[model samples]
Target chain A: MFFRLTFSSIRHYAFRFSLAVLGLAISVASLVYFLSFGEGARRLIRRSVEDFNLQLLVLPPAQSLTVQPLLPRSLADSIRSLGVGKVYSILRLPYTAGFPPRAMGVVFGRDFSSSLRFISRYEVVRGRDLRDSTVREAVVGEALAKALGWDVGDTLTVGTGRYIVVGVVKAGSPMVDNAVIVPLNLLMEDMGTDRLLAVAVAPPPGKTEEVLSLLKREFPGYTIQTSEELVKLAKSFVALGDAIRFGLSSIALFVTAVLLFAIMAITVQERRWEFAVLRALGATRWFIFRLILAQALTVSFVGWLFGASLGWGLAEVTSRVMVEKFGLDLVEVSPSILILALLVSLGVGLVGSLFPALSAVRMDVREGLGR
Target chain B: MSRLVAESLRKTYGRKAKTVAVDGFSYTFEPGRSYAIVGPSGSGKTTLLYLLSGIEVPDSGKVLYGDTDLTAMGEDARSRFRARYFSFVFQQFHLIPYLNAYENVSVGLYLKTGKTDHGRAVSLLRSLGIEDPNRKPYEYSGGEQQRIAIARALITEPRVIFADEPTGNLDSKNSEMIFRILTGLASEGRTVIIATHDLALAEMCDVVLRLRDGKLVGS
Candidate 1:
């Protein structure tokens, strides 16, 4: 009978009920979408960083850009003899613009053959690495190719120098698709490398923190970023996503709550007479209140459907856009975030019904009937 | 057996103004009897019924169900008492607009007894001369709806039935039909109390009380 009463009331004023449902859906779906995209991007970024063995790297400082230090020339020479297995030299430069073979983007250079196991996030989809003897050979990512249109056997220009495209690898990471790699010296000096850039160190298993401490002690001016920190930087409130996600979700939670509250208050007023009648007909004050609450739940549940869809849509759009912009491989959905959104919707419904329930409870059966 | 009782009932609205809606009134009703309280608008007849049924608390009085003092009881206890021992037939019916006649009649039984014996609910409807128990209250005639309300009042086997203007919305024939149902409950050892201006039904009740202000006038 509680359910029946709720259902009947909804049927009696369907247009109002639908309005309430639509309002709730927008809030719930949008919230879920926002949270999911952030989560998805987190995973994709982590996977990309891990493929290149960046997950466990220990940095010099919490704010360092040197993801791998053992890959640098002078640093490699010392680290190779410091009881560490192999120290492959790697360099990375991050500015607004770089050479054209990398085409005005972040630049990375390292010994590809010697450090392939440690620093090779790329897959060599088409050609070989720049060999020790090859003076005019380099490799470009698919995205960089799409941007500048160069393939195998094509001549590429970088930092006022030219090189033949010797190899290609399809690395699905955002960093790889937007990067250009060359032999360490060729990237910095021989290929007219304008910048020395930061270096990555792939220490043997369990020795990462030890070698990282040594590097930090040796070079006090430079910063070292671990794989976990790098991944966190790429996905978190680092720079880009904070402004958008935080701004939208905050606004959504606020505006949606107000709208929901208003709708419930109006509904309570319209049904005041009915509530009085129920109370007159042997329904307790609590019974009348529960009826109103049940009504709100039904309406809010409908609203959550739309809200969840909108949320999922936002995530899908976010992941796709990020992938296109920076080659991020974020997932389409986030289950945890979806659950949170539904729970929020349920809460909204319960909270919104409070005043309405009170209104029902406070009615005077005799005053309402006017007898 | 006493059906419903009220003693020294006093109800005041707000503090300073303290409009006494029902003041120092007392009444006792017997089982197997029908009675009506007749008065003009603003009289306290309906208020008295609400108090006796345990729906509202009297400020300084006691409502008794057999020996239970309802006014001193908790709100939940009052609600349970009403659900088990009484049925209300309001002037406006209070039938859930979404539910059909059968559903409405079965509600009292469902809540108090937690049973959905549709056969019993339907059989009660049939006895009331309901044309189609499956139809919503709005679809039935005024009299058929009153009949449905009577069925609802009876379905729970309540010891007392309170009707506020039981025939207010019905024609003469429909009014008489409702009157017959109330009398039938009375004859079956149930108390049937109605508040109304209809003299014909008022004449049929065992005792007819009158209310001038909040106090009762002589029968």
Candidate 2:
């Protein structure tokens, strides 16, 4: 009978109850959508870090606020002479490298043998790998090829010279998938400099820290970092993104609670006479209180179910947009998110109905009837 | 059934300018008899009913039911006592708007016990000539709604029934039917107390008490 009365009352004020439900749904959906962006960024960074194969990176220390110091050829030789591990020097230069001179894209000049030895799974999907006989041959990553519409044997312009695309590689990382790769000597001749940006060193297994300390000791003016340290540095950049997501979710929940409180307050005010009738007919104050709470819970439960489904759908659309516009692989919607959303909605329901329930319990039966 | 006794019951309303609705009024009502509290407007008839039924506490008085001091009990205990010993029918036919006639009758029973007797509820509504138990209060006519309210009051089978103008909103035919129902309860050895201005209905009771300006003038 209690349940019947609660449901009947809700049905009596269906429009008012529906507005509360809609408010909760929108709040939950906004929370899910905001958190999804954080999840996407974390996944993208983690994938990139995994693809790098835990190699130690060595870079020239910054010389000025706006200028990054470059590694000369002599420094590269000195690092190679240490024989602590296999070293691969890479020179990254920004250039317009498409058929119609598109905006800046990275051109990587690397030692072919050492790069292949350190970076595993650098497979050539089409044509052949870079060889000694082909001086101006280049290998474009999957994303770069797709963006420029280039296939094997197509000529890609880099600065003043054009290199024939001899291979299309799939590196399984967004950073590598959007780059153009060429030989170190060819790139040095084209750029008129022998300075490199960084050196990737794959130390013998279990000798990572040993090589790291040795490199820092020998090259005092350079920065040395292990792959784990690089990953930690990247994660630091995403902390602000996480804080923004938290702020957005908090604001959404606040708005939802306020909306629910307003609607429920008005509902209780409108039904004071009805509640007083129940009280006059042998209903205890506790019964009236619980009935109001039950009504709020019913609305919140239905709203949460609908909100979770809407949030999932919206998350999928957001993931697709991120992948298309930013080349990020972030399309995962975890069950924990849905569970959290439901819990938040339930909490909102409880908090929002507290004052209204109290008012119902404290109503004056005579005054209410008189009204 | 239990006899009701009130001793010098005093009640007042408002803080700034006090109005004594019931002042030093006392009466004793016997069981198994019908009594009418007849008075003009502002004669404290409804306030006297509320005090006797344990719905409101008096300012300085004692109301007893067969030697049990109802005025000394706590509000929660009084509510339980009221549920077990008394039933009420108001002038406004205060039926829950959301509930159907059948559900409205079952509310009192459900509150006392955690269960409802649907069969008894349906039989009571049928006996009251309410054919459709599924119709809400607003869907019914004034007389039907009054009948539904009476059914709800009778569902608990209390020792005493207090009604404040139970037929005020009904037509002449419905008023006679309601008066007959109250008289029939008295014949069945249950106490019935009604407050109304209708002298025709008042004359049908076994005893009549008249009040003016919150004080009893005739009996």
Candidate 3:
């Protein structure tokens, strides 16, 4: 009976409630769309970090993660002499904007003989794995291969050098999925430089910090960090981005709440006499109050339903577009984000309806009857 | 079966430039009888009905329904009492516009018992000449809408029914029909109090009390 009364009231005032629902839905959709990007970036960073499995990266001074091929090739042997862990030279060159082959592609030159973890992370889904670091052969990531329409035995051009596509690799991280892996020596030879961008080091168990301290002291002109430190840095950057996006979404949510509140207040005022009739017919103040609240909740819940679906659809479509156009997975619609949106929308309903329900509860039967 | 007593009831409206709506009015309404309070506009007939039903508290005086002192109880307790024992009909029919005939009548049962008796509601609407209980109030004529209101009143099976100008908005034919329904409730051994401007309709009840300037003049 309570549900009948509440829902019937909403149905009768469909247009008015629809305005509220639309307002709320737009707010929730914006929230989901914005937050999904943050969630996607965070996951990408975590997965990329986890996939590398390297304890330390040695980059040139003042360089963060960007590839700057200034470190000498002999730095690998110098780091290997420290007895902290095995070291291998790695080189990476990022494509500039408007590169026909791919704009966001990275040419990764890895020491295939020693970087076994890196090789294993990018599983060989087709063709074969890279062997013999001196061979002029390349393994393309699955997404890059799909983007470029490359298969095994295909020739690929990168930075004025051509190599055979020996294998296609797949990984959970987009970083690996959009990469072109070639032998370190061949890439160095192609670039006409004996310099290296970075060195990958595998430390002994429980000796990460000791190895890091030694490398920082020995290679003062380079930026050396463990994989965990890099992951933390990436997470902090993502967290800051998420906070700003959430803040932007909150403004929309506030507008939705205010719109709902105004509508409810006006609705309660117009139906004051009807509420009086209910009271005279034996409805308690609490009953009237709950009826109003239930009506608001119904509106908000319906809005949430539509908004969540629209937002998820938008995220999926945008993700597809991002991957197709830029080779980036830029949106993620996780279950946690859906749950959070639901909880926040319900809270908006409760807050928006509180005053209207109170006013209904406070209405006098005689005055409401207009007697 | 209980008697309703209103002792020296006085009700004043407005904070400033006050007008006494009901002044020292006293009456004993007996069960199994229909009583009509007949007066011109502003003579306090509706105020007296409100005071009697505990819909409005009297400025001074005690309204007792048998052993229960309605004037002494708090607002919520009085509301519960009204739910359990009293039902009302209004001048405008006051049927919820959104609800169909059956839902309107069933709501009374819902309010009283937190449950609905669909069978009882259908039967009551049928008996009241609302053959199609699925129609909204706007679809019904003024007379049929009043019948729906009366059905809502009867669904709770209250001991007392208060009708304030119950036939004010109806034609002679509808007014006559509404009076018949109220009188029938009296015959069923329930107290029925009505406030109206029609003396002809008032005469149909067992007792007609005249009010002038918020005071009872004659019966």
- Of candidate 3 chain B, the 10-residue stretch with the lowest lDDT total is B73-82
lDDT of 3 by residue, A1-371 (tens): 88988999999989999999998898889888888998899888777767775678998887776756888888888888888777777777875335464537678887865634653476899999887777789988888788778899999776668899999999867788888999888887788889987888888888888988898899898899877778888788888988898899899899999999999999999999999999898888888988999999999999899999989999999999889866779689999999889988888999999999998998878889987
Q: What range of 10 consecutive residues in model 1 chain B has the weakest lDDT sum?
A: B108-117
| Local accuracy of candidate 1 as per-residue lDDT tens digits, A217-280 | 7666556667766666676553367348646875766676677678778877766766665555
- Pick by DockQ: 2 or 3, better one: 3
lDDT of 1 at A53: 53
List candidate 2 segments past 4 Å from native.
A55-144, A157-239, A245-257, A329-333, A347-351, B1-8, B25-34, B62-86, B157-160, B186-191, B204-207, B215-219
Considering every candidate listed, which one attains the maximal lDDT? 3
* Rank ordering of all candidates by lDDT, starting from the highest: 3, 2, 1
lDDT (CA) for every model shown?
Answer: 0.72, 0.81, 0.88
Point out the worst 10-residue segment of candidate 2 chain A by lDDT: A62-71
The deviation in Å at residue B16 for candidate 2 is: 2.7
Candidate 2 residue-wise lDDT, A150-269, digit = tens: 899999877557899999988777666766888877787777787877777888889988998999899888788777777787677666876787588778788888888998899999
Error of 3 at A103 (Å): 4.2
Model 2: reference contacts kept, as a fraction = 0.46
| Model 1: DockQ score | 0.54
Better of 1 and 2 by lDDT: 2
Question: Chain B alone, model 2: TM-score?
Answer: 0.97
Ranking by TM-score: 3, 1, 2
Q: List candidate 1 segments past 4 Å from native.
A: A55-62, A65-73, A93-107, A112-116, A120-122, A127-135, A142-150, A229-244, A317-332, A369-371
